[model samples]
Target chain A: MFDYKLLAALAAVIEQGGFERAAQALGLSQSAVSQRIKLLEARVGQPVLLRATPPAPTEIGRLLLNHVQQVRLLERDLQDQVPALDEGGLPERLRIALNADSLATWWARAVGDFCAERGLLLDLVVEDQDVGLKRMRAGDVAGCVCAGDKPVAGARCIPLGAMRYRALASPAFVARHFAAGVTAAALARAPAIVFGPDDQLQHRFFAMLGGEGGFIHHLCPSSEGFVRLTSGGFGWGLVPEQQVRGELERGELVELLPGRVIDVPLYWHHWRNGGELLASLTRHLEKYTGRWLVQV
Target chain B: MFDYKLLAALAAVIEQGGFERAAQALGLSQSAVSQRIKLLEARVGQPVLLRATPPAPTEIGRLLLNHVQQVRLLERDLQDQVPALDEGGLPERLRIALNADSLATWWARAVGDFCAERGLLLDLVVEDQDVGLKRMRAGDVAGCVCAGDKPVAGARCIPLGAMRYRALASPAFVARHFAAGVTAAALARAPAIVFGPDDQLQHRFFAMLGGEGGFIHHLCPSSEGFVRLTSGGFGWGLVPEQQVRGELERGELVELLPGRVIDVPLYWHHWRNGGELLASLTRHLEKYTGRWLVQV
Candidate 1:
C-alpha cells in the first residue's frame, strides 16, 4: 500500500515542476520534499520525475500522479462531509474531460458554477465526445463526460441525458444550395461543415435523412467556428440544439429537419469505487444535464 | 511488407466510417473492400477496423493506416517528379498538423495556395506546438510544423525560423492596471490570459521581466480567442507577432517590452524517407514562413 503523504508529495513535485517550489507551496522544507519523493521512488522501484528544467513525470510517475489526484478529490469530499476535518488549507482539484460541444455551449457555465460553489479547481481537457473516453481509460482524468453508454470495466456509467442535435442552415444557404429541397442530389452537391475528419454527427444526421453525401468538405474544427460558419450561411451542418437554440429562435438559422432531433446519449463514466466526491459530482451533472438536455 | 492498396482501403473504412461507403469511396464493391481489409489483417495476423457504426482502427490497424498514409504521400511526390506516371485519376492528400497560432494568422492562406498549386488535399489538424509533435510520433500525421527542435527518431528536422512574440495589452488596460507601473506586486494582482494550463508563454515572459505570479487565471484555449481577449483589454498576453502585427501597428495593442522579442524557434519535422512530396512541401512552407515569419 502506498502512503497518501508520499503520493501527495510526488504530485506536488511534478505539478510545481520542481522540489523547491513544491516545498514552498506545501509549507515544508525543500529537504523534506526531496526526501519524500526519494522514499516513494524507492518503494515503487522506479524514479518518479525525469529531472529537467520543469521536470516531467515518467510513465510510472504519471500513473502515480493520477492516483494521487483521485485520492485528493476523495479526501476533499470526505473533509466536506466531516466538517470537523476541514482545515481550509488548500483547494481540491477535479480532473475531467469534456467534449467540445459541451465546452462551447450550456455546459461550461454549469460546470463553472459547480466548481465555484464546491471551492474546487477544474482541470478540464477538451476533446471530441468519441475520443473523450480514451482519456478516462488512460487514467488521465477521474471522469469523462462523453458520448455512448459502452461501459468499461471498473467504471460506473451513468446516462446523463440525450443531447438533441439538428441540421441547421442559414436562410440564404437553404435558398441557394437546397432550393430544390434537401434531397440526396442536393446534399451531394452542397458543401457541409464538419468538426473534424472523425466527426460522425453530420454523417449520422445525413444517414437518418436517407442521404449520405460528402463527409468533410468545409472543416471548422473549433466548436464556436462550427456554429458561426453554419449560421453565417457557409454551409449546412449538424449542430447541438443548445448551441443553435438562440439562432433558431431568432430565425437567424433555420432547421433543415423541422421537429427531428437526433439524440446522442451522453454518459458520465467514473471509477466505480471513486467515493463520495465522484457521487456528488455525478448527481450535480445529472441534474444540470436534465435541465438542458432531452431525456427519454 | 504491408500491401499499399489494402492499407488504403482500411484507411478509407476508418475515415469514411463504414465498409459500404469505403467501397463507394474506393470505387470497389463492398465485398471487394471487405476482402481486401480481411486479407491484409490475415497477412498481419491481427484484426483491424473495430466493428462500430463508424468503424475505428484497432491499435495495430492504426499503425498500418499511418504507414499507408506516409506511403501514399511519397508516391504522390514521386508521381509529380515522374509526370509520365500521372494518369490524373484522383487528387493526392497530404495530412499535416499545425500550431493554432500559425493557422489563425498567416500560414493558412499560404498552405492553401501551395496545396492548390500542387493539386494536393491538405488535411490540417490544429494543436498546440507542444502536443502537435505527439500526433506525428503516433503516425496520425505525416508531418508537423511546431515549436522546438526535438526531432523524432526517423524524421528530418529543419529550423524554419523563430516566431517572435511580445507581451501585449490594450492601451486602456495598460492605463488602468499599470498606472502603478509594471512591477512584481502589480502583476501578482493582474489577470492574465493563457492558452491552457500547460501554456508557459505568459509565465516565461513574466519570468523574463523578473516576476512570476499565478500561472492560470483565465484560460482561453482557442488561439483566436486569446488574441481577441488580450486585445479587448481583458488581460495581458504574449501573442505571436505574426498574429498581432496589424494590431501593434494600429496602436490597438501596445507592446510592454519594445525591443525584447521572445523568439520561439519552429521546425518542420517529417520522415527522412518521406522523399519528393515532403521536399516540395517543405520548400513551400519555408517560403510562406519567411514571408510572414522572421527567418533569423
Candidate 2:
C-alpha cells in the first residue's frame, strides 16, 4: 500500500512549487521534505517531480497527486460523517466543479445556504459543463453539475431537471431591428448574443425554424453581462427563465417567440460510492436545483 | 489534402448535434449531409464520426475539427489583410480565452474599446489561466491572456505585465479578527477568501508569517463576488490591486499586510504566425495592459 504521507509530500511540492515552500506548508524542515521525497522515490523507483523552476509533477507524479487529493476528499467526507473527529476545528473545504451560468443565477445562493446549514466549506472549479465533468472524471473535483445527462465511466448521474431558456430581446431592439417578428428573414437581420459556438441551445431553437445563417452575432461569455447587454437593447439572446423572470415581468425584456422554449437538461455527476456526505449533499441539491429548474 | 467542405459538414454535425440539423445549418438536404460525411470517411479510410444518438466525432475527427478551426482563424486574419472579402458585411468575431480576474477588472473595458475601434467582435472563453492556454493550443480559441510566462508550443508569449495582488480585509473584520495582531493563531481563527485551490497567493502570503491551519473559507468563483464578499466584511482575501483600488482608496478595504505583495505575471499567448491582425491586437493590449498593470 502507498503511504499517504509521501503522496501528500509529493502533492505539496508540485502545488506549492518547491520543497522549501512545501516544507513550510507541512511545518517541516527543507531537509525533511527532501528526505521524504527521496524515500518515496526509493519506494516507487522513479522521481515524481521534475527539478525545474516552479516544479511540475511527472506523469506518475500527477497520478499520485490525483490520488492524494482523492484521499483528502474522502478524509473530509469521513470527518463530516464521523463528527467525533471534528475536535473543535473548522469544516474541511470540499472542492467541486460547476458551471458559471448556474453560479451566477440561483445556484450560488442555494448552495451557500446548504453549505452554511451543514457547516461545510466549498471550493468551486468554475467552468463549462463538459469541462467540469472532465475535471470530475480526472478526480480534480468531488462532483460536478453539467449540461449532459450521461454519467462519466464510474460516476452516478442525477437528473437536475431542465433549465428552460427563452429568446429575449429588449422592446427597443424589436422596434429597431425585429419589428417584423422573429422570422427567418428577421433572424438574418438581427444580431444574436451567444455564449459560444459550442452553445447548442440557440442552434436547437434555430433548427425548428431552419434559419441560422449570415447573421451578426455577439458573444458574451459572462451570464450577468449577457443579460445586461440583452436588456440594454444590444441584441437578442437565449436567456434562462430564472435569470430573465424579473426583467420579463417588468417588460424590460420580451420573449422573441411565445410558447416555444429551449430546455437544457443538466445533470449532477458524482462517484456512486461517495457515501453519506455526498448523498446528503445531493439531496440538498435536488431540493434546490429541482425548484429552480423547469418541470420536465 | 483533405476536403475542407466535408470537414466543415462533419463539424456542423457534431456541433449542431445531428445530420438533419447539420443539413439545416448548411441549407442543404439531410441526404446531402450524409453523403458529404460518407465521402469524407471514405477519404480517411476510417469513420470520423461515431453517428451516435447525439452524434460525436472520433479521435481523428476531433483533430480535423481542430484543424478546421485553425484554418477559420487564419481565414479571418487573411480577410483582414486582403480587404476584398469584407463584402459590406459585419466584422469577424474573434474568440479569445481569458481569466475572470482580468474580465472583472480592466480587461473587459480595454477589449471592448479595442474591438469597437477596430470594427471587430470578440467571443471570450472565460476560465483559469492554464485552462485558457490549453484551449488556445487545442484550437478552441485563437488566443488567451493568462498568468505565467510559458506559452503553449508554437505560440508567441508577450509579457503583458505583473498583476500585483494584496491581502485585503475590511476595517471591521480586522478590528474583530486581528485586534491581537496578525499571528498564526489569529490566522487560524480568521477565515479567508480564495478563488480556488490553484490560487495559492493567500498561502504564499500566509507562509511568510506562517500560520495557515483549519480556517473557514468561502469559495466565490466570480471575481465580482470575491470583491463584494471581501468588502462586505465576510472575510479577508488576496485581491488584485486593480480590482480593489477603489475600495482601498475609499477605506472600505485595507491591506492585511503592507509591503508583502504577490506579483502574478500575466502573458498574452497567441499563434506566432497570427500575422498583421494579431500583431495589431497585441499592440493595443501592450498599450492597455501595460498602462493598467504596476511596474515591478
Candidate 3:
C-alpha cells in the first residue's frame, strides 16, 4: 500500500508547478513539503521529481500521479455516498485537457449543463488535439478530449463524434492564391495558417492531396484568432464547419476546394476507474455532441 | 560577429519546440540543426539550450534569443527599406504574449487595423497578466502586454492603460452566498472562480477588503468559460467590466459590493532595439488604446 499523504504531496507539487505553491495549497511549510517528497523518493528508491526551477515529474512519478488521480476520483465517489466524508461541501474540481477549438466552439454549451447539475468545477488545460494525450501521460488531467482514439493504460476512449474542418480562407485569399487552380502544387506555394507547431491538420490535409513536403505557413495559436486570421486574408486554414457558418453565409470566407473537408474524429478519454462523475460526463457528451459535431 | 545562420537555427529550435521540426522549418536536416546548436554553445562557451523534451533556453540562451528577436525585427525593417532583400514578400510574424482577459475583451479590435495596414502577422501566446513578462524573459515572444510596469534589462515598458474588473456573480449566487452580508469572513467561506493558479486577482481583491489567507476557488482557465462559470452560479469572480455589460444589463449577474472595482494597470514591454516595426506598432497602440482601455 502507498502512503496517500505522500502521493498527495507529489500531485500537489506537479499540479501547482512548484513546491512552494504546493506547500501553500497543502497548508504545510516549504520544508515539510520537501521532506515529504524526500520520504516519497526514499520509499520508491528513486527520484519522483526532477530538480528544476519548476519541478517536473519523472517516469515513476508520473505512474504515481496517475494512481493519485484515480484515487481522487474514487474518493469523491465515496464522499458522495458518505456525506460525512465531504469537506466543506465544496464542489469537486476536475482537471480536463481539451482542444482550444472545442472550447471556443461547443464545449461550454455541451458541458455547462453537466457542471451546473453536478456542482462540479472545471480546470481546463488547453492542448492540441494531436498531443492532448500527453497531458494524461503526465497525469495533469482527469480526462481529455482529443483527436486520436487510442486510450492510455487503465483509461477508456469513447467516440464522441467528429469535427468537420473545411479548408477555408478569405474570398480575397482564394482570388489571390487559388485563382490559377487549387492543386497540390499550388497549395505548396501559398501560405497557410497553422494553429501551432504541434498542429498537423494542415500537414494531413496536404498529404491527402499528394503534397508531402513543408509549406509556407504562419502559426496562430488562438482558436478565435485562427478564424480571424483566416477571414482577414492572412492565410488559408482548416476551420471547424460549425464555427464558420456565419462567415460562410456572409461570403467573407470560401472553401479552397468545394466539398473537400477533413473530419477529425473526437474521442473522450477518461480513467477506467474515474467513477460516476466521469461516467455521467461521458454519457452526457455522447448524447449531446451530435448537435455540434458531425457523425463519423 | 554572431553568425546569423547559427542564430536562425537557435530561434527555429525554440520556436518549433524540437530539433526535427526546427530542421523542417529551416529546410535543413535534423543533424545539421543539432550541429548548429553545438557550434553555438561552443562559441558561447556555455550551453544555449536545455536538453529537455521540449528544449528551453538557459540564462545566456535567453540573452542570445532576445538579441535574435531584435535582429529579426531589424532585418524586417531592412528588407522593407530594400525591397530587393525581401524574400517572396512573406508578411513578418511578430509573437506577443497577452493575457486571456485582454485577448477576449479588446485585443483584436485594438490591433486589427495596425496588422492589416502593415501587412504583418501575429503569433499570440496567452499568459497571465502577472507572469506574461516571463515569456519575454524566456525569449518566447517579441513583446508582451502584462500588469507589470517595470521592464527587463534592454527592454522598454510603456503604460497601455488599465482593465477595470468588478467582483461579480450570478444573481442567484449572490443571493445565496451574500444574503447575510458580504463580509470578509463570508467571502472566505464562499467559493470563487479563479482564472488559474497564476491569477492573483481574487487574492488581491480579498486582500483589499482585509481578507488575507487562501479561499476556496474553482479554476477555469478560459476567458469565455470563466464568465460562463460565474454567470452559471458556480462562483463569483473578478471579471472585466467590458466583458460583462450584457450580463449586467440582463440582470443575470450582479456585483457583490456595488461600486467596488479593481483597476489592473497594463503595460507593454518590447526590446529596446526592436527596430521600425516595433516602433510603428508602439505608436499605433498609443494612439488607439485610449478608445478601449480606461486611463490609469
TM-score of chain A of each: 0.82, 0.81, 0.84
- Residues A242-268, candidate 3: write the lDDT tens digits: 877878999999988889899988899
The fraction of correct interface contacts reproduced by each prediction comes to: 0.02, 0.24, 0.27
**In model 1, what are the clashing residue pairs, if there are any?**
none
The 0-to-1 C-alpha lDDT of every candidate, in the order given, reads 0.72, 0.73, 0.81
Arrange candidates by lDDT, highest first: which order? 3, 2, 1
- Give a tens-digit lDDT track for model 1, residues A97-210: 777676555554455456545545555567766567776776767788788587666788888777788889888779887888887667766667677756777777777768
DockQ score for candidate 2:
0.21
- Taking the tens digit of each residue's C-alpha lDDT, what string does model 1 give over B129-232? 66678877888777888886888878877877777888888887788778978776666555566676457788787787787434334556766556655776
TM-score of each: 0.68, 0.68, 0.81
Off by over 4 Å in 1: A13-38, A44-67, A77-88, A113-119, A130-143, A149-182, A189-198, A212-296, B13-24, B27-38, B41-67, B74-90, B103-119, B126-140, B149-198, B212-296
Q: Given candidate 1, what's the lDDT at residue A267?
A: 82
DockQ each candidate and list the results. Answer: 0.11, 0.21, 0.28
